[model samples]
Target chain A: MRAAYRPGPDAGVTVSDDGMSVYVARLPGGPLLVLDGAAALIWAEATTAPATGWVARVAELVGQPEDAITADVRAFVADLSARELLVPLGGDADPPTRA
Target chain B: MATQEATGAPSAGATVPLEVRIGFAHASVQWIADRCGADLLHVKGAALDPTLVPGRGYSDADVLARPAHVRRLLDELPRHGWELINTFVYGSSFEHSATLRHQDFGLLDLHRIYPGTGPTPERAFDTLWSQRTTKVLGGIDCPVPSHDAQAVVLLLHAARGGSDAKAANDVEWLWTSADDAARDRVLDWVGRLDAGLAFSVITGTLDEHRDDPAYDLWRVAARGGTRMEEWRARVRAARGLRAKLTVASRSVLVNVEHLTIVRGRPVSRAEIVAEFFGRPARGLREQVSRLARRSRR
Candidate 1:
């Protein structure tokens, strides 16, 4: 199922000052993950507000057509979801703001 | 494909900004504290009210737990990723906090007491907790002392900071440049916390409290003293004879926990024995040099 994503309830995330990297950790204990380049952009767009057409936004940001990036983006998001770092949005909820 | 690196335990240096790492550290500790049903107030460092000291930089997370809950929090911390790198006694002369490190989140100082506050730690925690507010760190709504109470805490920390420029800057922003009302608010908290003896360092009246047992402790802290002098002050400030003896005894013993941190590995028993004997001679040398410098001056 194609679903919008938000940072998982158990994840703690911080983005680099340049917006080029995203650091994510599972709560309490961790396998801290650093995502950069297209991955960082995907994580940022996927978890942003409106929770719709997020993958398309990532395609635009990276200067690629939606079709060209769709499969890869889905695969990346799926990877994160499996790790519980990012979760599919269940409803019309806004993404969280990082501190 | 966007590159992703899974850092099980990254090198000593981290690519993540320290503030960001510290924010996550606060969140992690807050998570552990909640599951254990313990209360903790994030303080100073990343927890400071941003308005009190503009652009203050902190290298670590600092949290003050209720005195009664400290032991439980200590026990539960290991269940999380926190490794106790330094025990409270070795953390500083005050013995107010223990230092722990996280593989991913860097360092956290779990303070049982915020030095300079409290006729008692229990009462001090209550005084700050009663007027608490919240700040979002790493997307977690962590409890912190009220803005005014933070101002007091910062000032107290600055009192013990000696000549550190950062401490001086904190004093400038929170106290020296503040208006009469802001000053009054800080003084009120100091009174409530029974922190007058220490806060006197900030007011330039430390001499007036010469009779107070803790006065020398504040004296050496606010005005850089030798290791020998610092240990003497700690012994004097200890409440009972047993505590005083404990503090005195600790002066000559090797702090193996501290040695581990300094060497970046656990010390051999022989290393510990060598340090145990070497420390007294080092203290004596430092004392002699200090006296010689004084005499020459």
Candidate 2:
């Protein structure tokens, strides 16, 4: 299934003063995902916006061509989804929308 | 100073982080303890080096006092704005009986024992007290356990808490900060606690990486036997049938204090029950699948 991505419902994120974003899973002893640079930007955007145009947005931010960045963004998002740091939007496991 | 004057009026201004407030509370508690002539030794979160856990936060100040002087602390601490909240009877190492709460300072867990339970030597508290030295932590001159003693307690705590990341980090800091002599001393104490095998296993793994090993030998050693050893110890520790029943009931019941501590609010009885049993089913499925995969290997 082609799944859209969003931040995991249980993810608690904290961005440090040094621009490192720490995404801790709400589950006890869950993985701590530390993102920096492009990865951090992708995570910030993914949490707030849909993942449909993530590649182009990230490419623009990182000064890379969309074609060059697409594969890396997909890989990163896939890894995060596998780790439960990113969840499939509009699925059975989809989180309730925030107000 | 009156209690209100000491704690000051509850301010609605910019709030300080809990960790920073805890630092000030440590100093305030020390000042009160010294005034009461009760020798105090800081332990656990409050005693950990800030350099090691940069953003580490604490919900309470853990202080160890001589068993003889506990009464004095109970009397004097209240005068300084620490109100007795509730007593806990869990078999925790480093905690005595009760907890105290202050408006500004948060919680204070008063202890009469060094390492609360497990396989610690009978005179562990006395030994730790004798070796206690003054260290300036967050500008508070407080007595802290000797490096060797602190290492033992930290390792045991980590093991008991199921080798959580924070605990592992604390142990790593202890290892890297200690000199060869201090390390040897810690190993000696681990030996006395009959935890040398566990200690070696944990340290060996930690040296290789920061990952908490799936199987922790330290936990086994802390129980003084295998996985079943802790239950047997608890049974033995219980004074009477009623005491044993109390322990058993506590294990089954949802501890509201635990919920409150974790959530930072007073959770209702129903919420506590829900929290206790609301283990994500996905986690269980994942664990089973992991075990199945391992077994297939």
Number of the predicted model whose lDDT against the real structure is largest: 1
The Cα local distance difference test for each model comes to: 0.86, 0.57
lDDT of 2 by residue, A1-99 (tens): 333565565443445455543323222122233465677777655555554564566678888877776666666767777767678674322332223
- Checking candidate 2 for backbone clashes, the offending pairs are B93-B116, B94-B116
Judged by DockQ cut-offs, the docking class of candidate 1 is: medium
Candidate 2 lDDT at B289 equals: 73
In terms of DockQ, the best-performing candidate is 1
Model 2 bad stretches (over 4 Å): A1-99, B1-17, B49-59, B84-86, B90-98, B116-122, B137-140, B175-182, B191-233, B236-246, B249-297
Clashing pairs in 1: none
**Poorest 10 consecutive residues by lDDT, candidate 1 chain B:** B4-13
- Candidate with the greatest TM-score versus the true structure: 1
How much does each candidate deviate from the true structure in C-alpha RMSD? 4.3, 19.5
Give the alpha carbon lDDT tens digit for every residue of B140-195 in model 1. 77999999999989999999999999999999998899999999998999999999
> How does candidate 2 score on lDDT?
0.57
| TM per candidate, chain B | 0.96, 0.62
lDDT by residue (tens digit), candidate 1, A22-71:
88878877766778788899888878765666766887999998778777
